[model samples]
Structures are given as structure tokens and as C-alpha cells.
Target: MQAKLRMVDAIIEVHDARVPLTGRNAYFEQNLLADTSKPHILVFNKSDLIDKKYRQPVENEMKSKDKKVHSIMWTDFKHKPMVAAADLIDIVKDSVTNMQRYNRDYRTEYNAMVIGIPNVGKSSLINAVRNRVLGKKGKATRVGDRPGVTMAVLNRITVHENPKIFLIDTPGILAPKAENIENAMKLALCQTVLETTLSESLIADYLLYYLNKRQLFEYVTEFQLKSPTDDIYELLFHIAKSRRLINKSDKDCKPNFSAAANFFIACFRSGRLKSDRFMDFDLLNKS
Candidate 1:
């Protein structure tokens, strides 16, 4: 953000709706807050994935603290290009216009930087916005599913009316070094790290605990998963079997239980398990 600030007039921070708090760069948020001169806009993307039950609570939480922050629920791929472009134009126009009206010659031309963490749809958002503005599709450089796909920042140009807008796309953020559980969880969920510091078994246990509390035991029971009698390892083994994650050993031709357990846990963490299990934020605060 600091590097892009030198080139841009304003910053639009895009974050995921399902994990808004987790989908932000701690460094950018802190540094941007300290520099009051750089006008910033908060955009929550992927509202389509949010559960209706939790949406109001999340919105209320954000609004209660920062009332000026703007949010839009982005969905419908067919119309997303137009909607996103219009929204970006509107935001930049309003922000820059006010600065100019106040005789702030320092901030002119409305150069905006699009910033966000990995897999939060930042590239997609930029492409959509550019397509609408240019009356043609503008390609934004993007990497694959792997973490740290964006190793270096790149600039993309968009023409709006008579002026050219420079949009700087930055690398996906890894959590600033922190030890707090909440921060850790946020980093783990947002970044594209292939291997997490937290153990897979621990994550699986947490998922189990969350599901049991939400009365979503049926998900576990659907596969006829057996509850662990006493040992967590045994439970994981059972989970692997239920999920049908088996590997035959080369030597003895035995099922590779360890490999199976890892596969199942990875699927659970990546949301492939179709579990709505999430760490209860409200419950965390109460406790």
C-alpha cells in the first residue's frame, strides 16, 4: 500500500464478506489509518456467500464502529462487470471531487489502487471494473490457487471518460507476524498457504466442536461417521474411512491411514466438506 500510495490518489480495500475481519492486511489497515491524507474506501465483496442469519450482525458490527465506510454486496457474474465499474467510478468521483472542491490541489485526477488479500476476488473485481470503463475486456494479471500467486505488484490502466486511471494491484497479504488466536485464524483462512502452522488434527477437532455446538451433527452422521471413543487419532481414522480417503501401501498393501487423515482434514479446512461450521465470533466474545 505504501508503494502504491505514491502513485494513487485513493485506496479501495476489498475484503471477503464471509470473513471480512480476516480478509484484510493488518499492515495496510494500520498504516492507512495512520495516514489520514490518503482517502480510503472499504468494500465488502462476496456477499452472496454470507448466511442471512449472520449478515445483519456483521454489518451492524462494522457500522457501529465506522459509519462512513461504504459497502456493496457483489454477486451475479453476468452483471458484476457493469455494477463493479459503476461503483468504482462513483466512489472515486465522489471522493476526489470533494477533495478538489476543498481546494486540495495535492489530491487530483482520482488515481485509485485496488487492494485485498488472496482469493478474495481482487483480480476479478479489477477486471470487471475495467471491462465496463473501457467498453472492452481488460486483462488483469492473476496467479492460480496457490498462495503468494502475486509475487510482485503490477499496474493496470483504465480509461474513464477523458482521463486515464492507474490501478495498482498488489501481492496477496500474509498476516503480519502475530501470535493471537483470532489473528492466526484470520491469516490461516485468508492466505493461500499450502501448509498451515496449525496441525490438521487440531483444525479437525475445532471443526467437530463447532459442528456439535451448532447442532449440525447430521453432517457427521450423514457419512455414518463414528464418534471417537476416547482417542482423537482414532476419531480422525474413522473420519478418513467415512470420507473414503484411502491409499494403498506399496509394500504390505495396507490402507495408508495417515495419508487418509491428512486428506480429510485438508478437505475440511478448504470447505470441500460442505460444512457450514465456523468459529462462532459472538460466542468467543461472550466467553
Candidate 2:
């Protein structure tokens, strides 16, 4: 990635909007952003999953925290009309043009490198911008629901024709530095890390703890619970029995708690537990 950085004109760092505070890659800060002249844009993807009301506040907080971020964008790659993608094109153009391009100022075309931790929509952003600018029908890069989809740095993809814009897609690079355990769990909760890296029950327990701490009990109604409970096993058992996820091999036909945990995690990921408006780092400063 450092080798490819020299050839690119700008940087687009994608992150999960739900985990804006903890989803960022520390490697980028220590390595990629070493050059202050580079135009770096921080894109908070999956913004649709979070409440829209917090958008401005989050932006303000990010700007105050990281002045190196030349621009900040909120995007949902799958959102129709794709206004964010198009607007991103404009921002990139202005950012690269206004900033010092090092030795590439004479170049007519713009090359931006899309980077982030796994599954934060780096490829999706590339595909969306490519489709929007070029009016292309298919994806310029591969996209998936899970992490580690793009395993390596890919060739430059053209997005626009005039002042021609191109995007370079890179594998999601996680920071190797040790992080706060709670913040790391937040990353897992937002699905930035692979699901298999942590046990489903463990992640589910953290989710329950987080939600309960926030006093957000919408999951109770979503899962048909009479009331909110602090116990992860009890919740999983209730969901398992309700959904009839049984251990058929067992003589007593016990509820499949593992399967139920997986289902619970899925519901949280899809934002079903919070009426499609969950934010992972809400009141982070206060907490």
C-alpha cells in the first residue's frame, strides 16, 4: 500500500458510520497520513444504519478531532439516486485541485486510493462512484457483506471522463496496535471484523450490554419478549424457542442457543433491533 501511495493523487478512508469513533484504522494515521499535503477524505459509510439527526454533530466532532481530514462524507452505497457518490466526485475534484498534489499537479486525471478496515464499504464506494461517473452497468470492483473481500491492491478504475477521475481499491488493512477492549468489541459489533474471529454468543452478549447501558430496549419488542432482560442466555433461549431452532439430535430437543445467537447478531447488524437507526458510538464521550 505504501508503494501504491506514491502513485495516487488523493486518499479516501472509508469507515463504518455506526462505529465512527472506533472503526478507523490506526495504521493509516501513523503511515498513510504522514504526508500532510495529501488530500485525505474520511468517508463514513453505512450512514443509513444510524440516526440522521446525529450527522452534523458527528461531522463537527470528527473535524475537531482530526484536522488532517480534508473532507468528510456520509454515504450509503446502496442508497438509490446515489447523491452521495456523485457529490463525492465533486469533493474529490475540489480537494485534489485545491491542495498541493506534490509533483503531480500537471496531471489532468485524478487518482484516488480507497482504503479502510475490512467490510467498511471501500469497494462499494469505488463501485458506486465508478457507476455514477462512467454510467457503467456492472461493478468496477468486487463487493460483499463481509470483511476481507478485496484481498489486495487492485488496478486503477476509471470513474469520470472529464478531468478524468480514477480510483484504486486496496484490501482492508486493520491496525495491529492493541486497542481498548470495549472499542474493539464495538468494531466487531459493527461487523468491521470477521464474524468468526469472535464467538457469536460473546458478541451478542456485548450487544445486549451496550443496548441495556443505553436503555434502548427495542429488541424486547422486536424479539417478542414481554420485557427487557440482562441475561444473554435467557434472551437466546427465548429467541431459539420462539423461532423453533431446536437441537434435533438431542433427546430432549433443547433450544439451539448458538443458532439463536447468530440470528440475534444478524438482527442487530441489519438494524432490526433498533428500528433501523442504531449508532454504535453514541454518547461515547459521556460514557
Candidate 3:
């Protein structure tokens, strides 16, 4: 929040579409709604992963609390950047208009800051924006696909001729020190370092439960998994077999079920499962 206050005219909180609620900062909703200084735009990135059915429900929920929400379904490298940049401009324009109407002095000359957890595509979006505006080819410094790729916040030049806008890219936050349930959910959804922080078993269970609830029981039956077990390794082994994940080492033909299990869990968490496995909010509420 301090960084946002110091650097930019408005704050655009980027979140993954696959796990919108999970990818938010614990204090983000509170801080954003409470703050009267500058307006906020919640940019739901990676919308292509989310099922069409769940999108409206989530958006409706957000709009119910705050009417200023705008959503975009982003996919592919060619279009995502352009869409992101355009959306930022629209959001800034709307905020500026409101501020002026109320006789407030919210700065409009500076570009809006794009903030979010790691691997949320802040840099990629920025680069795409710049490419269109500048007519020159240069990459954004902090862009990367792997986890923990961005170690620190960065400031980059915008495409506008007069430096009218700037992009302040922040490092992806780890689990907050405080044990807030909201924070945990956000980290699980947004933070790129999925394997180290969250247990593989937890992710597996989430997938299993989601698939089962959707009446997609083949996922479990195909793998021939036993009932929920405390053993992470055993659960992973079952998942690997079900997914037909096997190791083909020249030295030993043994299936690398352990490695496959980890990969599967990661993919599921990242929304690469190629199926609509929306989180059962009822279960989450119960937990």
C-alpha cells in the first residue's frame, strides 16, 4: 500500500482468473475498499482458464460489494498485453473523471501502477503495452514464466510520449508473516512458488474433491486411488498412475511416480488441468 501511495496515480491489482479469490492479498480487499485516496481496478488475469459458468458468479460477487469492477478473459501472448494496457488506460480515465467531478486532485499525469503476486504476468503485460505505444521493441525487465522470477519491484518506462504513465512492477510476495486465513488463500492462488510453500497433498485433495463434486468421478476411479489417506506419497503415486505419468529411464524402467505427482499437483494449481474444476466455495467456507 505504501509503495502504491508513493509511486502511482491509481492502483490496478492484477489477479489470476483461475483463482481470483485465492490470488488476492489478505488485506487487499479491506485496504482497497477503505481507502479514499485513489480508486482501484481489479484486473483478473488469465481468465481463459476459468470456466465460463463460474466467471459471472465471481464477478457478481465482486460487483455486489463494489460496482467499479471490470473483468477481461485474457489468453495468448499476442492479445493479452494489448488488452491489459488498454484496460489500464480505461480504468485510469474513469478514476480521473470521477476525481475531477468531485473537485479532488487525484494525479492523472502519472501512469497507473500494476501490482500483484508473482507469476501474475505484470511484466509481460507491461512489455506488451510498451510495444504498442513506443513503436520500438524492448522487453520489460522483470518478465519471466518460472516461480520467483522477479525478486524486486521495478519501474519501467511507459509507451506514452511525455512519460504520462509509468509501470511499477512489484516482487511477488510470499506467505505473509501473519497467519491470516485470507492471506493464506491469496498466497495459494497467486504466489508462484507453489511447491515449496503448499503441500502437494493439499493441492491433490483439492483437485480430487473438486472433480468428485462435479460428478467427474473418472479422475479418481481411473487412478484406482484409495480413500483419503494422510500419506502424501501414496496419494501422489495413485494420481501419477491415473494420469498415465511414467518414467522412461534407460537405466531403470521404474515409473517416476513421485516426480509425476508433483508435476500434476503443480499443473492443477496453475489451472492447466484442461477441465473446469472450480473450487467448491461451500467446502472452503466449511473449512
Candidate 2: where are CA atoms >4 Å away? 275-283
Cα error, residue 221 of model 3, in Å, equals 8.6
Mark the regions of model 1 whose C-alpha exceeds 4 Å error after superposition. 67-86, 100-108, 189-196, 226-235, 242-244, 250-274, 277-280, 283-287
Give the TM-scores of the predictions, in the order they appear. 0.76, 0.94, 0.72
Tell me, by TM-score, which candidate is best: 2
lDDT of 2 by residue, 48-152 (tens): 888887778778888887888888888888774268788899999898767776677678888899989999888888888887888888887898988899998
| Model 3 Cα lDDT, one tens digit per residue, 1-287 | 46455555566677666556565565654554355455667776666655667666676666665654443334333346676666656556666445532432454466566667678776776677677677668786657766567676665566565536676766665445525543443344334555466654565555555555565544344445554344556666666666666676635555565566567556655555554644435433433
TM-score: the better of candidates 2 and 3: 2
Candidate with best lDDT: 2
CA shift of 258, model 1, Å = 5.5
Specify the poorest-scoring 10-residue window by lDDT in model 2.
Answer: 275-284
lDDT (CA) for every model shown?
0.58, 0.83, 0.58
Query: In order, what is each prediction's RMSD in angstroms?
Result: 3.9, 1.8, 4.9
Q: What lDDT does model 2 reach?
A: 0.83
Tell me the tens digit of each residue's lDDT in model 1 across 53-160.
665666666666654455444442233657766776777666655553334465435577777766666666676666777776546656355556667777655636
